[model samples]
Target: MLKSLLSDKPGARPLVEAIRACRWHLLAAAGFSALVNILYLAPTLYMMQVYDRVVPTGGIITLVLVTIVVFLALGTLAGLDVIRTRLLVRAGLRLDQQLAGRTLGRAMGSHETSARAGQVMREFDQVRSAIGGQGALAILDAPWTPIYLLFCFLLHPLLGLLTLVGALMLFGLAVLNERSTKSRLLKAHEASARAYAAQEQVSTRSEVVRALGMRRGLVARQLTARAEATGAQSEAQFTGGRYSGAIKFLRLMLQSLALGLGAYLAVQQQISAGAIIAASVLLSRAVQPIEQLVGAWPGLVQARAAWKSLTDLYEATGDQDEAHTLLPAPAGRLDLQEVSVRMSDGDTPQLKQVSFSLEPGQMLGVIGPSGSGKTTLARVVAGAYRPQLGAVRLDGSEYGQWDPERLARHIGYLPQDSVLFAGTVKDNISRFEGAADPAADQGAIDLRAVTAAKAAEVHDLIQSLPQGYDTPIGPGGRGLSAGQMQRVALARALYGSPRLLVLDEPNSHLDQDGETALMRALKRAAEAGAAIVIVAHRAGVLASADLLLVMNKGAVSRFGPRDQVLQALQGRGGPRIASVS
Candidate 1:
């Protein structure tokens, strides 16, 4: 069974490995469950002894001895139950430790929306909780239901038959409960997820919503989504509640019937009076697991759905450990050969057959009108997007050849959005890199970050902040002006003295001085042998461009020396070519 579960597939590997790590604990919990269930029979046996043997004979010593044994067994049973619960909880924690980082990493790095990321996280939590929750305990106890039924049979054939009928009824009710509530619960979950995503979206962009007078409208939409989700959930819960009440009523009725029928058998002299109590105890025990299972059915369903979702996501993302042997450091050289990218559902490629090369110390300017695939090209070059055709190489090594984290140190990309995370200025500039050792020299790390800030000419600006490099900034760099955020982001791109820099609209929010500082920083970076690609609309920003590539409708229309490309554009009466001079 273990061998069958431990699949060789990449997607299953993480979850399988997590389960393997916790196998011993799970096995121990199962073992404890067996011991605990066996001990549960102590009460039935004790009651039977007192009624059939001690009560009729009036032997006080016999009653005392039986009660002592039962007490010891019950105590042991309680201890084992505690151990079982702790073992399962440990297993759940271990599973989380194993997969949470990977899940969050995939969420952050993938192109999935924030809503999808949140949904995946909730799914992962569901699976983790199911491992240790009452649902798991109920599942473990379910198999031992037969133990009680066996005892019932040993007590009397008629009692065993009665218990079987009651068990089957409870089982039927559970099945009915599942059928009636499954779709409703599923719908509720999806609606809740959508509502959560909408709320998250609005919260993240609260500033925009308030400024645009969209607060009331967005809130109304969110409330509507929430109401629908609540309605579905309430209906599902109400249906489940009805079954729960019925199950409770049926269980009580069955126990009473067992007692009454036992009495009839005893009065007829068909079975001993002690057998009556034993039959009632056994019947209730037999159906107890079923009742608990029914109550925990929703959690089990969620867990099953979450497991499938996680597996699908893992499969879609492919292997996380794709790293090979560490290569030597990259030099400031980049090459793209016949690279192309197409949307999954689109017929037209976003970028088509584009090729380019840049040696150390060279700078390339990309100019294009809106929708010319400039951003896509920049992403492809930055190793953010893998081309479906051809390759992107840094220092003659394909992007795939290098570990992503290691390669990122050699490549700097300032995206069009220039979004900054909430962190200290130093941490932001340092890309959140930290020393593993608590006693490590944090000063050295900060020094390097400060140097990057200085390189980008943002050092003075940062120093002007309340705490200088230690100043905390909110998400999206809310503490800084737009130009300051861009400059700070530029410093981040310059950190580690990366071999290649890709800047998209780097000066979009900058004033004249900020633009001049940015241009100066780019020149210094180039002089220091960093190959750079700058995508921009401002021709002035491309003044020092060694080469110019003009893009037209996702294809390179012209690529040559800066002056030559400009002259061609001017001569052809193409989209107005602004002069750098």
Candidate 2:
């Protein structure tokens, strides 16, 4: 069953395998469901006994004993139902425990757009809820519907026929419900997801929106999106609700008709008065599972969609089950050979045939006009994106040869935005390493973090804060100025004296003092034998650079010793390179 649901792709099996791992528990739940359904017959049987045997004989003690027996059965049924629910909930927790880390890792590493990434995690939560909630209970009970019909048949052939007809009609209604709402619900879900993504963007960039007087316009746009989503959802619900009402009406009418038919049978000497109530009870039970299933169909649909989305995402990302080679620490030598990257649509390559090499202790400055792919090259060297062609190697081995986590320990990257996470200054500097408790492994963490801060020349500035190293930074480094955030980000990159440092416009937000600090930090890193790549729009930040690479139209225009490249450009009138320098 699991194999049929999931493809044989490397990463695609985990989600299904997680459910398969709980097969025993599911079977046990099914067993409990069977017992519960059997116990459900006790009420009808007790009523029949009261109406036919006890009332005719006036046997009070007999009635009391039967009541006690049914009560005991009811109590046991309740306990079993609780146990079944707990089993399902525990299975869901185990699924989460087994797959949450891997899911989060894939979501974070996804090359998909921001909106798609947000939807991926939401889909995970939906799958979890559907598997563990009342929807699962309905599914478990659905299989026992045939047993209920059998009991109705034992009561009378005519009553059994009525139940089968009603069951089939309800089944038809369920099919109609599915067909009516499935597509509409899917559209609503997508629209809602997009609206939520936009709202998140507004929250994360609230300052930009408010400062630029775009708040009202953005809010109005959000309102329109939300209204459209709500309208689509409402339409689906209305369709489902119409079917639900029809099914409910059919169930009530069927139960009533069974009673009337039973009374007629009694008049014709075919059944007892007790048989009338019992027939009605049996008919309701026979169709109950179908009704519950129909009611839970929306959740089931959502789970199905989530399952497919996760399966496709896992296939795309591949699994991390294969062991990576444990290579020695890199010595900062960097090489890019015939490297090129293109859009997935096979558009022109963003970085075409870009090749470069930097030995240990060498500092390379990358300068280019906007859209010249300098940033793309820096990302390639930083291992953030793998090129479609050729290779990026550190110390002589391809980046793919090393474990990603191990490689990350020896590389530092400060992107153009210089973003910081929510943590104390020391915590951010340490990359959130060590225990949360101050007395735990924080001593070593603090030592290394402090050293990095000093190297970035941000230690004195941090010391001037109200809590010094422990000062808390809000989301997006909200508590700090742009220059301060950049300095802190630089310190984070410098932590543990990473062998390869990639900085994209690190000095963009810096004042003269901050720039001086940045220059000193670069010089110190180069002196420590770290291979460095710095992308800059201004030449002043490249004073310590030993080599220069100039990019134009996604291709390298000049590459050589920094002085030689600058001299050559000067001879060419340097207009093309003016903004770059």
Candidate 3:
């Protein structure tokens, strides 16, 4: 899963391009932060001088002017700091927006695992936060630290040594913290991912659990997983925080020791009082950046871990070797040449050396017993999965050669369990395409005509409530019966007027009247020159077909015109059935 998040680097281009995009704002913010730090440090050093020598020299007016200058400098620094912060924040927001746009666009088109997508999204958030928060401080303080250190070294070498030691110690502490917590951090992240997956599973299948009276069991399992994950995370965070606190306390103690030593040197007259005072001020300034570095250690570690996870996700499932563009409407002819599919676990093949062909405007009925791979065959034809050793072709051209988007335009597939989104019927039918009447485009299929065709055959028994086609359907079309939902799915597929239509178990929940209406619609579609494939177990639906294919153990056991196939099945003592009531 982690393998899918690893995207090919945009090379030096994206990095430099992103920087250039926000360069002006970054420069302004950095410049202002430097000015603020310099002004902030100058007043403290000057105050030490005034106390140690200026007042003693009796320069009252000069001292007053200098004090005023300090206040004005501080005010300017404070104002600039605010402006800089706002500017950097805006720049960060813009950068995040741009990166997120690119990421989302890639995500939509790439066939990555869901786990990998989640990891990518998590990493994106971490990067965004870093830029907006600690990242900004790191940028400002990192550059300023050297300049401030140089000033301290000039003022007093002893103070400079102390500041250097403190910075080193802080760095050592952060490194130690990272090393100790890295494993725990990774474990915590794994736990979180599991908990999220569990929660999603429970939410997505809530109805099934409730109906099966397993709600309590499902909830218990979810809560247990969540609690375990929470405990792991809390333990990791607590351990890291305790270690950080200890380091901070030790640093503070060393700071006090440094100040005391500097004061003692001044009293011995080994150093000027002004020098001691300035040294103390500089030591404080030096420790500030170190403190911030220590404080940001946890976030940095977590962000790195997230980034690694994202890279791993990308590596696992990012590559797609079969990158053919989908073709426009297939010639309404499909041929499966000795196609076979095996489970990823290397179990017995689900489909094996199955070969069949449907001519343009033909209707093929697929029939089989339970677990005989009828639905699987339908999905194969629909291009949901690639057959291991064979090929699916449209109009004698390999199906993979067609662009996915263009192929979708020509082929309409309805799964056994049709799902509907939460929206008005029109909205669900149009999906991302806005609700311009589906009937408007020249070649556009009319969804209403599809519905009318089904209704003419008497399939649409119940009119949609409240607003007809505009009525809002609950998620998954929960308010509708199974048969009603099936009809709606049929309407959607017909609305596209696709050249090739694949319907899996469309008659599963339909009553006699509904089945009649559906058969009429299928006949109408066939008459309109669309190739139709139906996967079914019922004889009524099968008898209406132009051809029948009987599947057994992943192979086509029998195939011919409907009458001949039925006659053969009857000769074997199969249930004698009628084609239509």
Q: Alpha carbon lDDT of residue 183, candidate 2?
A: 95
How many clashes does each candidate structure show, in the order listed?
0, 0, 20
> Residue-wise lDDT of candidate 3 within 200-233, one digit each (tens)?
7677667888889998887798789878777877
Q: Candidate 3, after superposition: displacement of residue 531 in Å? A: 2.1
Q: State the C-alpha lDDT per candidate.
A: 0.87, 0.87, 0.70
List per-candidate RMSD values in Å.
Answer: 2.5, 2.3, 4.7
Worst 10 residues of 2 by lDDT: 572-581
- The numbered model that scores best in TM-score is 2
Q: Candidate 2: how many backbone clashes?
A: 0
Task: Determine which window of 10 residues in candidate 3 has minimal summed lDDT.
Answer: 313-322
Stretches of model 3 off by over 4 angstroms after superposition: 1-40, 53-55, 58-64, 99-123, 274-281, 287-290, 305-328, 337-355, 369-376, 386-391, 396-400, 435-463, 548-581
List model 2 lDDT by residue over 1-581, tens digit each. Answer: 33566777877767767777777777888888889888998999999999999999999999999999999999999999999998887777777887787888777765444465676778888887877788899888888889889988887889999999999999999999999999988888778878988888789999999899998999999999999889988998899999999999999999999999999998988988899999999899889888888888878777777777788777776734547889888889999999998756557788999999999999999988899898988888888877889989999998878877778899999989998988899988988876434666777888999999999999999999999999999999989999999999999999999999999999999999999999989988999999999999877788888999989888888899998988988888652444233
- lDDT by residue (tens digit), candidate 1, 100-175: 9888777556633335556788888998899999988988888999889988888778998999999999999999
* RMSD in Å for model 3: 4.7
Greater TM-score among 2 and 3 belongs to: 2
Where does candidate 2 stray beyond 4 Å? 1-4, 343-348, 435-440, 573-581
